[model samples]
Target chain A: MLNIIACFKWVVDEADVKIDAKSRALLMERVGYKISDYDRNAIEEAVRLQEQHGGNVVAATVGPSTAKQCLKDALSRGPERADFINDPSFVDLEPEQTAAILATAIKAKEEYDLIICGEGSSDLYAQQVGPALAERLGIPCATCVNKLTLAESKKEIIAERKLDDGMEVVSMPLPALVTVLPDINTPRIPTLKQVLGAAKKPVDNITLNDLGQTYKPCLQTTGILAATMERRRLKFGADEKNILVIIGALLKEGVIA
Target chain B: MNFNLTEEQELVRAGVREFCQKYVEPLAEKVDEEAYFPMETVKKLTEQEWTGIPYPAEYGGAGADYLTYIIVVEELSRACATTGFTLECHTSLASYPLYKFGTEEQKQKYLVPLCKGEMLGSFALTEPGAGTDAGAASTTAVLDGDEYVLNGSKMFISNSPVAGVFIIIAMTDKSKGTKGLSAFIVPGGTPGLKVGEHLNKMGIRGSVTAEVVMKDCRIPKENLLGNEGQGFKIAMMTLDGGRIGIAAQALGIAQAALDESIQYSKERVQFGKPISSFQAIQWMIANMATDVQAARFLTYHAAWCYDQGLPYSKEAAMAKLFASETAARQTNRAIQIHGGIGFIKGHKVERLYRDAKITEIYEGTSEVMRMVISGNLLR
Candidate 1:
């Protein structure tokens, strides 16, 4: 049976995101989390391929200790098992650093014929990580893939990658990486039975130290500018005479220009 | 309990807001003015499988909880009330009947597509003289052996012109009063089933409300919804969530107007200072903000109740009554703030002012909502 390993993230569930109005920061207090929507897409693709060609699919995510829900959600959706890199230190990893840590986890396994990942996480949506992790792993990777095929005779997979300008189909040997589009297939929801069963299923918990890096940090950012651009406002007066002044002001500001 | 939204809801807000602003708002006014239905938008949403929110995925719908559906509807309406209304009534008024009562085969054939948004759907309940009192429907469906011959007219029904199929309520046993009413799925262009001219409306014009005339509309007995005598109850139950949609619709219109007004206040100068600096304008904006937020919480709370499978009729009615009226007040203030400019035909606030009032009238009027709320309290 083919073995597929899907890389995923425990992100603030887009469905439950709460933005702090005051600081313009993402809220995290009892703020619910879930497997990133894109990563779920990637994992679902792996599950589909496994069902198609007889394989075992293991889903994995790197997030804080509270990210068990991400692994649980993934496991409930047909992955044989899951990996959650748990630690508070992981609370603020940049995209590149995250890719490195995930690559280390994948390398530690030293197994699996294929690796799949979401095109992007819903939280950041930077469209990084997947390809970056592939680079770190020294494996061939394709992003925005719509089709995945396993050629039994050739012992390889042929995949179709959609690009902004055009499309390309590439053949990757075993131990390859593929990032899938959101439209690839609707991610199946975990039922109550699956939710209960996830507790029994194994979710291998790893930490940042498990990656064997003594010192920490890479690609540090200066800081985030909250509300990068303030929206321009133009109001009209309460009375009819002021309406002309407002219109004239709007016209002068080139708002109506 | 903190009634504020959690993290996932925020993400939903951002994404849905982006979608609505980019897709819906730009075309909203034209849709309302021209009565042009968005077949493309419907097709796009169905393809993305967004048509069915809160319905179980097993039935080919999103299976999101009711709260999630409300959030989406509110966001969609914030961008374009018409788009939200289409999905709201389509699912709540038309498809809910099937999900509540249809057999397995019926669900597979009709419920599946309706939830999938693969086809436009509607509830044919309100006739010319029989809107709030749907039991007064003059439309008659007589049992004609294998097929039921339906001959009645439903007026002011949204999505009629473009609806692929309709969930029609007809009097099968008129002598039995409301108990004798039966519902059916009448496919569009079924020889005698036709959509009448679109009604020109004050706002949310993108949603086409027209008369659905059944001139000997024929359908197999298999298409009968629920038991032979349960249409009115089904109709009432269907509007439970449908009312919430209108409330959210009110919230959306109010939210848009308030957003515009606040932004405008910050920029427009008065007494050699930004109008936002004035206490009076700030007070108006503050009240508008609080009212919109309160209405949102009420609507969302009712939606959450539905998700928990609890009784939410009273909460739903309360939300509808408060939100719609609040929205009208806010929109009226929005126009007042903008003065003569807001009174223009094209300004967002003017459109909002017009749009806000409909929420009070449709699904259930404020008085009707009060009755529903007060009536539920008695029960």
Candidate 2:
């Protein structure tokens, strides 16, 4: 493989994401962003491939200035380097738009043999970005790939893609797009040593203007909407009141035994 | 008497079993063959916060009880006895005393690091002369001004050679007899304290077990654990918990051996049929299965009682007694069933047979367990 560019995302921390009480929007204030869980899967897969086939695994993300942390985490994982398209407007881009921005940035200075992205983001779970990005770049795309075995001689791969029923095994040419499932490979934790190394690794910070791509929204929200909180129905224990109420309900329904 | 695990308990078992099956099983042989402590494996465990499992979460532990701790130990032991032995030393011996008796400041200083897997801890209650009778310990931490000058050596101590901290017991008030003893928190690299060469062991060979030599080692007076005359009681109380862990360890090795024997029985052909089809083979497997189940029941019941805060000292010793001895029989039977294959160096049953012998020896001997349990009842 020549180069593998993995698509990453910086979102509100999955653990801390909350909803705004009034607006019903995901409360993002002070909820520091991180790379989407699946995106880490992509980065690990790319790194694994790089280790096997000898190439560079570059991490690319389109997010706000704070999104740089996602690239930092990705580099900490196993990527050769990272590129970030930092713009306030990049925060709300849909799969296609995010892919478009990343594609432009990836194509600007370097040519890649393969483009790898996660099957989907945990927050949105859209399952669209990889194919759409590949279409935009005009390369063959494979999604939900569970296994990747390279044929170094042929410069191709035998991939097993996860399907609804089971798994579909296929082979693809070198210059392709692959969206990986989380099971493709377990992501390695950054050792304290690796974390320190990541702090020093150079990450390229590129603007939307630098990639010759402007803000373009593929999907837009009407307004900031909070999550509709669902209340759990409570069940009473074997207290006297609960027993009496159960007996009353049983008599009403004519099924007391 | 409850046979079913609660939901949280079930989750604990499943999570631990899954982690061990996926991560530990593949590299277990290499770990044993190489005598490696496996930094990568410990790093993975640190991610799950498995190092300090039985203590409260405030102390950097997983906040689980004895049952949950055994679940982790049993699963890890199933694949790799080395890791299980290491965890047992940390949780059941070194750090547990601090959790039960140490002051808040002491816990913060010693317990947190060990429980978080940030630092490995060791227990030094055993001396060459004091193998079974902790009261016979010759190591003395004589009070001198603001410090206690510790002199004497500890032998067959687990995790000592590589440990960051050691919880040691020594005579503080010699005239008071056993009551004269006290425990101390000896930080590694304290001047005059030396970790001797690692002891070569027959089983659980991957985990480091060595001698600790203390030559006029001085520790602050604050290092005393509990009261000045409580060392013997503390060491014995800690062993009550430690016995449960040894039971879990024995069960793990026996289960692995049984599983291996079953597979071999099905695959190995004898007298024109799979050995599994033979009545003698069937009988041996039957005995192993029943014994292993019996051991598990005893171990889990002991753990359950401990979790419920009941008087589990009798139950724990019973569990340790039955499980360790039963594992020895089960592993021996497994090896016999495999015949020549089981005697080979690389065979799983061979390793199990070797591993099974140690469980009966460590954490107090099987004979020692009977004495303790009987002594408790007589009291």
Candidate 3:
């Protein structure tokens, strides 16, 4: 049986975030957390693989104390259990530090055949954690994987990576990592029974001290500003001349070539 | 006095909210427009094991508390009130009585399948002659040897068209009045049980409502719920719990109306600025928001009381009264905020306005809710 680890991130629900009218600063006071968008795909894929291959799927995440709220949700999606490595200091963790923590936690597990991650977190689309964790673990890593098939007896995984130009097919040995795209699969909405069942699933809460680590951030996040676009308010009559002028304005604004 | 929902409760709400957005919200318009039951969505709900969220797992339920079940109903109603009412009627009106008063044999035979969603359940209490005055019901059940033969016609029965089992109340002793009422578990397809055609309704149209006629319908004596004279008490207690569900449903309808109004106000521009900038529109929205929040607290508190095993008959009545009125008022304001568009067909607010009215009418009327509340207080 193949054992899989799905790594997810608890990010702020962007829908709930409000932008300041004058300063364009993000208002996060009332914001709630959700599993990062693509991370849901990663978890679903892991669970699907486990269901098909007859194995166990454990979900893992690195975040602050509030991130504990995401564990039940993650578990409800189909994980057998979860590993939450939480620290208040993890609030501002960069990609590398996050990857390091994940790698350390995975090493503590008895055995795992595959590790899956989203292409990137929803808040910051820095696609580095999955590959970095794989590098730290010294395993082959695939990025932008939209499809995956496990050949359990052969100890290999066949994956389809979605690239800008075309799809790339690759076969990698077991114990490898793949960061999946959102389109990999439509995540199943956890059923009421599943939500209730999640309460019985085991969760291992490992503090920073439990991992025997001292961490320093090499990268820091500055203030986040909302992206605002000012309307031009250019009025044009419904005529060929005005349409031509609109096209010229669009070209001048670099909106169209 | 913890106002916050428990962790599992919050998770249930979020999960149900997500489920509603994906499955229920998409078909809401079609369900209303065609006045058709969305059986596909019902099957999905059964698949999700949400038909019986509050019951014990031994009976094939999710084993969550009443608050979590309320949350599920609220979220489903927020998307489609019809679907929400369908579940509420099945669980609260039908399955609840059996769970509360049925014999062990009756539970295993009936409640299990209802909880598992293997068979839909319905309650038949209202009749042509009985509305608020349930003691005036003319239906009769005469015990003959090993069976009780039933003869009656129930009116405005929700889920009768699709239900596999029915909790039917009939007069076993006319001299005893309300005490004479008796409840029985009659499986669908029982001899002489006939479900009439679907009734045309202005609100919650997608929920199947029909006439259930029992012409010499016979069920085993073992199917009697509780004692022979306990039907009225069982029904009243069941409705006491069912009021919480209806209150939650009202809260959902109001919340949906508020959401639609807020979104529309921000988008619809007048005087070169969004109408939300105007004090008149802002006042309406503020009132709607306040009312919706208050209704939610009342509804949730009632559900919490039930979960705590506290006496919540009065609380449920109060919540049903306040929340249903709030729903009616907020939906009206929502339509006012939407202006002409809200009156047009296919608009969510229009459908919500139609759906909100029934919350004040069914389960218990607002006037009845007041009577219940005062009756408790004066006692």
Best-fitting candidate, measured by TM-score? Answer: 3
Candidate with better DockQ, 2 vs 3 = 3
Model 2 DockQ (Cα-based): 0.02
Instruction: Give the per-residue lDDT digits (tens) of candidate 2, residues B1-379.
Output: 4587653454455456657877887777777776767668777887777788878778988676778789778878888888888889888999889999999999999999988899888999888998887788889998899999999999998988878999999998778878988989999999989998877778877888889999999999999899999999899899999999999999999899889889899999978889999999999899889999999999999999998889888899999999899878988998898898789887777777777788998878988999988999898
Lowest lDDT block of 10, candidate 1 chain B: B6-15
Candidate 2's TM-score: 0.64
> How would you order the candidates by DockQ, starting with the best?
3, 1, 2
Give residue A112's lDDT in candidate 2 (0 to 100): 84
Which of the two candidates, 1 or 3, achieves a greater lDDT against the reference? 3
lDDT, residue B311, candidate 1: 91
Worst 10 residues of 2 chain B by lDDT: B6-15
Q: Candidate 1, residue B149: CA error in Å? A: 2.7
DockQ of each: 0.07, 0.02, 0.82
- lDDT (0 to 1) per candidate: 0.80, 0.82, 0.92
| Clashing residue pairs, backbone N/CA/C < 3 A, model 3 | none
lDDT of 1 by residue, B246-299 (tens): 888888888988999988888889789998899999899999999998998899
Query: What is the C-alpha lDDT profile of model 3 across B147-214, one tens digit per residue?
Result: 99999899999999999999999999999999999999999999999999999999998999999999
The window of 10 residues in a row where model 3 chain B has the poorest summed lDDT is: B7-16
Task: List candidate 3 segments past 4 Å from native.
Answer: A235-251
Query: After best superposition, candidate 2 residue A159: deviation in angstroms?
Result: 13
Candidate 3 Cα deviation (angstroms), residue B376: 0.4
